[model samples]
Target: MGQAAPSKDEVARRLADIGPGEEREIGEGVFMTMHRLQAIQPLGDGWHRAQSTEGSFSVELPLPFNDFRVRAQATDNVEMRTHTVGGKTPGLLAWSASCLARRDGKLGPEARAPGSDKIEVKGTPPVAHSRSVDLDDMTCILIVEAQGSDPVPPEADRLRFLHSLKRTGRPAW
Candidate 1:
């Protein structure tokens, strides 16, 4: 049988083991290949969560090479973001090209924001590259997005979810 892909828990462990400004290779030739990951940490009010990560990766194969940073929050649910900065050239064409190259799985149509950007998913398998966001500052493009995903223990509704789970010693499911 083929080698099994690394699990997110394994990824989290590797990430947590890394120092704030360190990097690790979770997967080769993949987005996780050239990464230097920090731990998945808590933002605020969320106690169960340990940390979040911020780092970049590069692909130097196929046709268009790209360099981008990845940020993600992993709990019972996983949420992530990618910002591409270098590659072919500047302008929408480059952004689109990189974004297209970095398509993971499509965001559920129902959840897609009104003006979510279009991406191409042909180059790598599911999530080959990272998404690109156009910004003017250039210095602060890796801003974190809001988190609203339904976690396993259901951190979304933290008050009841956290309280009940702690007492019951069971997931809110």
Candidate 2:
């Protein structure tokens, strides 16, 4: 006869002890992989460089952050790639990319120089900054949003996050 299956509690205990960068089979044909988050390295004065999981872009954020990537269907033929980085402290940043082909091969009228603006909302932070860049057939937008009770992030911090976005010429999608 086959061996009895492990108890739920026993499986939980085994999973609890698994270390990062490790993988284990808890049951027949069932595997779990543990991944360690990339370290957020400091660049002095409360700023750190946050890189996308795909290494396509990097931006300077005021605090340690965790980032994730997502892909969504934008249209029948185009998909959107979104990379978001946020910290527990007080800000959220994201980069989004989509094919420029959807826009009839031209930049939209809103595609102006990168800048910051004040957006007043009753119970939310009032600052939103964004910039758009065109790379080959892709259009990428970088946005930094203020969070928490503060009316806005420090001017320097907001600008740093907005102006520090760098793309490595890699395809975002």
Best-matching candidate per TM-score: 2
- Model 1, range 1-173, lDDT digits (tens) per residue? 53575798976666554543344655432333222222222334432231111222221111133333443332323333443322222222221112211122323223333233222233322222223332211111111111133111222332231121111111110
Candidate 1: the clashing residue pairs are 23-36, 40-51, 40-52, 41-50, 41-51, 41-52, 100-120, 102-129
Q: Model 2 Cα displacement at 28 (Å)? A: 29
lDDT of each: 0.28, 0.51
The residue-level lDDT of candidate 2 at 151 comes to 44
TM-score of candidate 2 relative to the true fold? 0.53
